[model samples]
Target: MSELKLNAIDFISFAVAGNTFKLKANLIGPNDQFHSVNLDIAPDEIKNKTIGEIEKLALQALRSA
Candidate 1:
């Protein structure tokens, strides 16, 4: 066999609560165990607000930036 060796790897795993989750980022899972995960970005909660309110939110971000 060649002398090359595996020195590092990238992995991910996660656990969840009622509506929240704890993601173990950059984690190396056990060799015999299988872990699967999916990523999602929750939609913003601003949909029900008025357009003026949304405009206000935009300005707020510009001010912060």
Candidate 2:
């Protein structure tokens, strides 16, 4: 098997709830495994974060999906 790594994140949807945001995404991993993840984060945490940073956070959530 190939090494596990984050390949891509297809952000399918998003919505705001209270002080946080819920992002629905398809986390693409090694070997084309797709994991659906609902990542909830405070806007303050990612408002200034780069796309790469946000993707990293989403990928982390995918691990527990």
- The lDDT of model 1 is 0.31
lDDT of each: 0.31, 0.60
> Any runs in candidate 2 off by more than 4 Å, and if so which?
1-17
In order of listing, the candidates' clash counts read 0, 0
1-65 in candidate 2: lDDT tens per residue?
Answer: 12334445455344544667666655565657766667777767757867677667766775554
Residue 60 of model 2, lDDT score: 71
Error of 2 at 9 (Å): 6.4
Residue 38 error, candidate 1, Å = 24
Top candidate when judged by TM-score against the true structure: 2
- Encode model 1's per-residue lDDT on 1-65: one tens digit a residue: 11222222233223334332222212123453332222221234423545444334333433354
Q: RMSD in angstroms, all models? A: 17.2, 3.5
For model 2, the run of ten residues with the poorest summed lDDT:
1-10
